[model samples]
Target: MADQPEEVRRLLEAIDALAAIEDDATCASAVTALLNDWPTHHARLREIRQERVLALRDSGRTWKEIGDLLGGVHASRAQQIAKGLRGTKRPVKGADE
Candidate 1:
């Protein structure tokens, strides 16, 4: 589609190339390598997204606007992300407490 990002297109092409591999062993090895490297790739993606969010905020976009742009998260949640706060997990409670 015309709206698809170039990076996404390239990723799809890479997946296609992987799917086209003929040798089972080679394909398995390639998949294994990708799995091993995924955490680094995922972290880089998070960094890029956070950078963009900060840039948007610096450009005077409101938290609500940023949240809408970020696929409908709440304004406070957007602000938390922009401020580098990790999402909080609820503490597990003991039954006796």
Candidate 2:
């Protein structure tokens, strides 16, 4: 969090607050809602990551370095993921239009 943007830090703090709920039924309901909407968030996050990966690639970062940053995924897989996301049209933040 020391290096993360303020928005990211706040979001994490909010999530942590939600996770700290003590009521059983409330927690269950919250978990249910999260699970129901998780796929949408998951997809959006993947799209964002793919855009970032492509931007990193364009900035001269090697595929291997990107793979290392992305949890040890192989360079080939990272390339494939980036290619797949090209059709999504989600641009990286602060990247060229």
Candidate 3:
């Protein structure tokens, strides 16, 4: 849970609210709806993270510095996340598909 995002907290709240549903089928349906949307939610979180990375990079921070601020990943990994390198790489997958 150390690296969990803030969005997860909100999602947990939504899941918890499902407890009020008495019908099993209805409750399961609601839960499924929430779970199904997770990918989109995750992508949004990533987009926000990337924005922060760009802001940091614009402020003259190096990938190593960014990695340090982010959880200690390698510099190249940080660079890839912040500003994707050129080549024949595929586009990043978004939550909405």
Candidate 4:
């Protein structure tokens, strides 16, 4: 893929290496290694995405536009990401409250 990041390339290579293993023990070990390392990679990826979303917002892009570019994520959700808010649901304010 064009312009793929080095981390992503390494991840793909690791996946390929995992897939090529025929020995069950080796496969298990590889899978364990991947699982062990996944959280760090996942966090890094999330941080990168948040940074990009903020950058896009700062570059005169509307949340709706960013959401569209992000494969139809809701504008509010995109805004939350740009603001570094986790996707946790909060109680809505009702008229009675």
Candidate 5:
């Protein structure tokens, strides 16, 4: 099935709303609403985001570049997530892999 642009808009709107909320409980509920309303959209969004990260790395871009292109997340965190998703045996510093 093809993804609709409106669905992505809705997901972004919902995330924006959640981020605007001050209370943790309200934020949680907002996220739940977003998940229930657009589970497939969120899943697709995640896939797209992951692909972007991978492509940035493949293009010889640094983790900082990838993170900046995707959003404002830290470079190290983006690198870690990318490595984990690719099943790389990254050093976890004692925690379970």
Candidate 6:
């Protein structure tokens, strides 16, 4: 991070947040820098997110449960990823799943 401009470092952390929420200036800056550093990783990261969601979903874990297991990502984010991976149907609704 030292090599990064001060603005860049702070934005990287901010972008990580935006990835899970909505985007804004900080996220845009961070994303620009991150892509400069690791363009190839985008696809890889997406694939992994999809894979993680699928693995946990197929194992019968709820979105909330998977999120908890996945270092505290929001349950909604977990649900979307998992549902996307499932390809046909979304993950079961409610905590009952």
Local distance difference test scores for all models = 0.88, 0.84, 0.80, 0.88, 0.74, 0.75
C-alpha root-mean-square deviation, each candidate: 4.1, 11.7, 7.2, 6.8, 9.1, 11.8
Cα lDDT tens digits, model 1, 1-97, are 4566898888988988997999999999998999899999987877787889999999999999999998899999888887777789777787458
Clashes of each: 0, 0, 1, 0, 0, 0
Q: Which stretches of candidate 6 lie over 4 Å from their true place?
A: 1-37, 83-97
Candidate 5 residue pairs in clash (backbone atoms < 3 Å) = none
Score candidate 6 by TM-score against the native: 0.44
Better of 1 and 2 by lDDT: 1
lDDT per residue for candidate 2 within 1-97, as digits (tens), equals 8887798899788788778999978987987898899999989988888899999999999999998887798888788778864334678888984
List, residue by residue over 11-75, the lDDT tens digit for candidate 3. Answer: 66666779778999999998889779989987887788788989999999999999998889788
Model 2 Cα shift for residue 82 (angstroms):
1.0
Query: How high is the lDDT of residue 75 in model 2?
Result: 86
Q: Show pairs that collide, candidate 4.
A: none
In terms of lDDT, which candidate is stronger, 1 or 3? 1
Better of 1 and 3 by TM-score: 1
Return the TM-score for each candidate structure. 0.74, 0.66, 0.59, 0.72, 0.46, 0.44
What clash pairs does model 3 have? Answer: 40-95
Model 1: lDDT of residue 29: 96
Candidate order (TM-score): 1, 4, 2, 3, 5, 6
> What's model 2's lDDT at 86?
38
Residue 72 lDDT (model 3): 96
Off by over 4 Å in 2: 1-16, 85-97
